[model samples]
Each structure stands twice: as C-alpha cells, then as structure tokens.
Target: MAGVGSEKVFENDKVIVWNFVLEPGEETPVHTHEHSYMWYAIEGAPLHIYDKDGADLGIFEVPTGAVYSLKCQDGYLEVLSEIGKGARVPATHKARNDGDRPYREVLVEYKDAMPAGGSV
Candidate 1:
C-alpha cells in the first residue's frame, strides 16, 4: 500500500516506526519490516492478514487493548520465541477492529521489518 496519511519515523537501530490510521476494510499491504515490531490494539479488533511464499494463510482478529510483541525470526519456530527472544522484537501482524468504533493502540516497542506490502 502506498503512503497515505502515514508517517515513517525511526527511533534507533534499523527500526522504522510506522504510525497511521487505517479505515474500515482499508489497510497496508503485507510488506516485510526491517525490524520486528510490537503492536497494541487500541480502538477495534483489526483484521490482520498473514502471507508466506506469496500465499494468504489466514486472518487474525486482534481485539482492542491487546498487546503483542514480535521479533522477525527465521521460519515459524522463531515466531514463537517471544519470551526467549526477550522483551520487544521484530514481527509482522495484521489487525482489524470489527467493533463500531475505530481501532487504535501504541506499539510499545518492537523491531521494524518490511511488511509484505499490499492487501490480498
């Protein structure tokens, strides 16, 4: 997805912080993040789409006020090492808030990697 009202500001390391508001049924494509990112659900349950090897796997519904951390590790196993990796890390996720209100949250801290880049 192209940059709309998006903002890409970096904190430190190779991490790029992405902050924006996605409209209903509107979202950013599956682009890989440079570093893993921590995502928090603020307003609604955002529908997150995951893809691997150019295939859409499934949709993950993240409710409001939910907090998650990611560290772009290799293969599927690395994705499970949340505690082992310790604290915040790079990760990819698609969130959708289905409630009547909009979804919002502050990704406490996580590595930023390139999101797949585009909707399914």
Candidate 2:
C-alpha cells in the first residue's frame, strides 16, 4: 500500500530515497518494503507499530541521528559480516506517531536486480 505521507525524494537505478514526516497523532498507511533499505533519523520521536488489522505491535524509540539497516524479514539485525543471503520479498508494516511532536526520517532503499519473477 502507498504510505499516507511518504514522498519519494530521489530515485535511480541503484537506490530510491523516501522522505517521511508524521505529525502528532499522524500515521502512515499500511505499506510494504520490498527491498533492503536503511533509514536516517532526523527528528527522533516515539512511534507505534501496528499490523494490517490495526493491532498494536509495539512502541519503538526513534533516536536522533540514528542509522538503521533493515533486512526484509528481520526488522533490524546486526550486520556482523558482509557476506550473507538476503530476503527476496521485503517486510510489511505500518507506523504511527505517538509522541507530541513530529517524526521525520529519510529512507534509502536499494533495488536488488528488480523482482525475479515479475513486478507485483
């Protein structure tokens, strides 16, 4: 699903960049990420994760200037080694701002040779 307020800032063959902004009590629509991506936190704030049915997943902290590399299946895994297999299909989730301030972050998604079978 398309994110409610996510904007594609830049895109190329190798990478696609997205800018996300959530105000107080704002939320992003149910969406899925189909590629390996990293995020840079701009305005850190409290956020809540939810499933497609709107079930509360958990609360997560968005630290300022924090960098996170997220795999498809695993949400946030430590990159101990550079050699490892990645997921073919990415993960899906929704996010909401539970804090009193705004939440901002930059996401850089790396396109991995396109979809194998075909584009969804």
Tens digit per residue, CA lDDT, model 1, 1-120: 123225654457644455656666565554444434555556545454544333444445566665555545552213322332333222343333334555555542344443453101
Error of 2 at 66 (Å): 0.7
Model 1 misplaced stretches (Cα beyond 4 Å): 1-5, 14-16, 50-54, 75-101, 108-120
Clashes of 1: 43
Cα lDDT tens digits, model 2, 18-89, are 898999898887787666667778988887877667887677777777766655545432221122223122
TM-score of each: 0.55, 0.75
Tell me how candidate 1 scores on lDDT: 0.45
Query: 83, model 1: CA deviation in Å?
Result: 12
In order, the Cα lDDT scores of the candidates are: 0.45, 0.66
lDDT of 2: 0.66
What value does the lDDT take at residue 73 in candidate 1? Answer: 56
